[model samples]
Target: MWIIGFLLVLGPLVTLHELGHYLVGRFFGVKADAFSVGFGKELAGFTDKRGTRWKLSALPLGGYVQFAGDMNPASQPSEEWLALPEEEKRKTFPSKPLWQKALIVAAGPFTNFAIAVVILAAFSLAYGKIEIPPVIAAVSENSAAAEAGLQAGDRIVSVDGRPLNSFDELSDVVLPNPGGKLTLGVKRNGRDLNFDFTIPTIVERDRFGNEFRIGRLGVASGPGEVVPVGPFEAVGLATVKTVDIMKMMVNGIGQIITGRRPVDELGGPLKIAKFSGEQLSLGWREFVSFAALVSINLAFINLLPIPALDGGHLAFYAAEAIRRKPVGQRSQEWAFRTGMALLLTLMLFVTINDVISLPIFSS
Candidate 1:
């Protein structure tokens, strides 16, 4: 069941991502030879009106669109591509305008983001939003909130400069700023108070011995409510949710890079699968939310200026735009090779960490 769930989540994401590139490529008059969902030997397929071979492959892990004149599915150009007849050359990705190439490459990740936004909006409208109270019910002794002069019964009206209508919204802000002082606005009785205090980044361990570092405010939120939203309102809220999650991810990565958070907490495919299974067990709604988070992560990861990714291609394009010439093939190849090696090594490392945290391996 878990394996099935994992594949279900992976398939649509890959399809949507590749479709983005395919659609944009077609729009720019660049021909795509094949649209493949997964890799390896083709399991099933058909040719479309545009002569595009759409197929499903055995791997089931991911997919890609092979453009006309691409050396491989990775879109590397070849000698044959360069020596093509002038008419054919115009139909290949390499011969397109620089901006057109960038757009086609960038469309995949942006499409993933769009899918996430739509899913979130639909779900929000159906189930409504879970709204937490902004009122602080209690403040723990000697904690950040206590030291900041926060008291029980105080209402948290805002954090930093953002106004909050719910405690969950305020929590989203405070949770990512651990060990950093933040300006907080609270309403105590009839008077407003402002406090600045550093929140603690506490290391917490689960029953399975997996550890996580999270921000602790030492303040408890009051009860929560479910606010019904119309489709339009939910769409807007979904956009907000997407942005907030992106910020959280950026900050979390920065914390890890700066040595403020443990690198061991980083996860790989196995960890994500485990969580996906857990979410499935919780309910369909939870599972959908988990998928949305993954979609956002997909967008964020692809946008990083690393080689072999869309962003890497964009980086080369940026250089081309500035110098009025594309980067040398050898340099681009070496950079992509290096990036691929690093990404593979990191994936292996994180998978090992996931194994260590498994109950079967834990001492």
Candidate 2:
């Protein structure tokens, strides 16, 4: 059941991505011959009345769309495309204006962003949202919170005399102040305990190859245990949630490039499936949140300037617009081949990490 749900969830995201290309390509008068969800041997499919072949393949991992005159799966056009019959050449993707081609490539990632917004809205409306109080759950041994005399069950009323509402607020205040002291008004057993503690900074990693420095108090915070918001308040809260996640993702990527995070944590299909199964067991809300996070990730990834991806193609089109001539085919082909090799290598590495990181393997 978990596997089935995972497939259904990922399938639409992949299909929507391909649909973005299909829609934009057709709008630009380029013929798209096939839009397929998944790869490998075809499981089931039927040619549409419009002549586009819609297919479901054996692997439920990812999907693609084949444009008319595309010479390969990477969608590179051949010399034949340039020499085609005049009437038919009009339908080739290479014949589109640079701006239209750029838009066609950019559509996939933007669609992922749209998916995130919709999911976030639905989750906020349905669940009323959970928020944790600014209470300390546990302090790490010999850590900053413990050294500052913070203990379990201390209801943090304020920091520096400012009233605190939720755990999210507390984190925002603390995360940037690692190894720095902050005044805390804690309500204990019928008494207000005023104290000062320095929060420690620890490095953490997210889904992307990025690292972040987070304040460590060694406590767990959750929804409603701290503060809760209603429906209208929830939308603003949801938007903030989306924005915060995006910031963390950006920071993580920075850390990766700076050598602060290792590549081992970078995950691929196996990691996603593992996470999907785990979230499925947790129920609908958690699964929805997971999906939202992945959606944001997809959007960011597609924006990267790597050949064979939306971003890569957009870069080429941008250059064409500026220089008044497309990049030489040989140069584009070499770049694409390099990009493909790098991508496949990264995928394989991440999958290995996923397998090795399993608890069963640890024992």
Candidate 3:
């Protein structure tokens, strides 16, 4: 069942990605020969009215659409295609204007991102959101909360005289006002404690291993209180939430690069499969959250400027747009090869990290 669920999640995402390319290509009058949902032996397939063969392959990791003029992505067009009548050649992807080609290549990643946003919006509306009440759970020794006279068990009723219903609301007020004095109204020991507290500068580690200063008040939040929201509000909140998650991911990647964070924090396919299986046990909500997270990861990852990725292709397009010419096929191939090597190395490294990080593996 876990395997089935993983495949279902990945299969649709892969199909949706390729469908983006196929639809955009057709929209631009480009001919696509094959649209596949996986690699290796075909499990099921059918030719569409446009003569495009859509197939489901045995493997489930990823898939692609083969455009007519793309006999070899790195190879120059064949003499046959070049000699073809101008009308026919015009429909070939290689013969399309640079901008059109770039858009076609970019559509896949864009579709993934768009789908993620829509899914998040839907999920947020359906499940509602739970946020931590603006309540302090504890104050660490010598921490900013301690210095601010925050008690271990205190309900933060307001910040700087503004009533806050949740810790999330307090964060909006506190994070931006870091290092500045603010008035806090707390309910503790059957009495209201009002005090002026200064937010402290906190060091946050990024993905690549570097640390940056941010605001902090060593106060822990309790479990979130679920709040229902309307569709419009859900959509707005989901967009904000998505951006927030993406920021954290980008920051984390920076920390890893700076060596402040270990690569072991990264997980590859193995970790995802394990997580999918575990989420399956917890029921639908956890599974949906896992799916949402992976979708966000997909969006961010494809945006990386690594060749063979959507971001890499976009980078090439940007260069072409600047220089007013396409990159040579050989150069593109070389860049793709280098990118593939880097990607494989990273994948293997992260897979190893996943194994090491798993307690079961240690046993």
Candidate 4:
């Protein structure tokens, strides 16, 4: 189940991501030499008529597209690329215009985001939108809300001065701020009041025993109605959800960097496999939802301004645009090498962390 779930979730996502790059590159007349769904040794594949080797590799973690004149899968330009004939150079990625290159690189991450938005929109269409008011129905005894003087029947006006439209927005603010304090604006009996309190961090476990640390206000809102949504409205809502997920990802990474969140919270391929298996056990709906979340995560991670990533390529393009020339070849080579090293080190750390957190390793 674990292996199957891992493949089911990552296989399509990785393939689509690479396909985005391949399609965009082809659209720009750039020739791709290879399209791989995984890294390392090639397990199985075939060469297409266009000379592109479409293959499945041994490692199932991630994939890449190697374009013409590239040194390796990272898309570094080969030293001999400049010596290629004019016609050959025209079809290589390095010979493309800055905008075209950027678009080709950006397409991969954008495709992942699009996948997430589509999945979310489909869910919204099928199940309708949950619209719950911000009014507090109850506050738990001795909880953060209770200690902050919040009471039943109090309508939450805002959190930290941001106006609230629905109770669902509260989690958006709270979940990313474990142990952090916030000022709440509330209205009761036609009067306004403000209360400040610290959010409590709690460890939550799913039925499958997967654990998560999150902030809780210890307040409850009435069960909101699921209102049917039009196709357009569903798409709009899904876009908002996609953006919200991205915001949470930014917050989480910032917390980790600032020491607000533990480094161990970062998970890697193994952890994802575990989660995929667990979500698969719940049913297809839950599994699909998890897939959407993972898709957004892939998009988010790939769009970071780190070298050897899609965002890194875009960053170089931005610099090229400003400078009216590409960065020195030596500099790009060193930067990519550094980036690759950092990525590998981080992957190793997270994989070890994931292994240690597994049930077999738990004391």
lDDT of 2 by residue, 184-290 (tens): 88898889998876666688865533355666666555445333556667667766777777787776666566665556557777667767777777788878788
The candidate that achieves the highest TM-score relative to the unseen native structure: 4
TM-score of each: 0.91, 0.75, 0.78, 0.95
Cα displacement (angstroms), candidate 4, residue 275, comes to: 0.5
Q: Candidate 2, TM-score vs. the true structure?
A: 0.75
Among all windows of 10 consecutive residues in model 4, the one with the lowest summed lDDT is 70-79
Clashing pairs in 2: 130-223, 131-223, 131-224, 132-222, 132-226, 133-225, 133-226, 210-252
Q: Model 2 has how many clashing residue pairs?
A: 8
- Which is better, 1 or 3, measured by TM-score? 1
lDDT of 3 at 308: 78
Ranking by TM-score: 4, 1, 3, 2
Tell me the deviation in Å of residue 8 in model 2: 3.2
Measured on C-alpha atoms, candidate 3 has an lDDT of 0.77
**Residue by residue across 1-363, what tens digits does model 3's lDDT show?**
557667756667767887888889899999888988899999999998877898889998778899887776442477778888888788788888778877887888778766777778888788788878677877778987788788767888888888878888777655644456778888988899887777776767544233355567777787876788898888788788778878778766775777645576688876677677767667887777777777778878888989978788888889889998778888988998999999999988988887786666555
Q: What is the lDDT of residue 64 in candidate 1?
A: 81
Query: Which pairs, if any, clash in model 4?
Result: none
What local lDDT does model 1 show for residue 311?
A: 89
Task: State the lDDT at 105 in candidate 1.
Answer: 91
Task: List the candidates ranked by lDDT, beginning with the highest.
Answer: 4, 1, 3, 2
lDDT of 1 at 241: 88
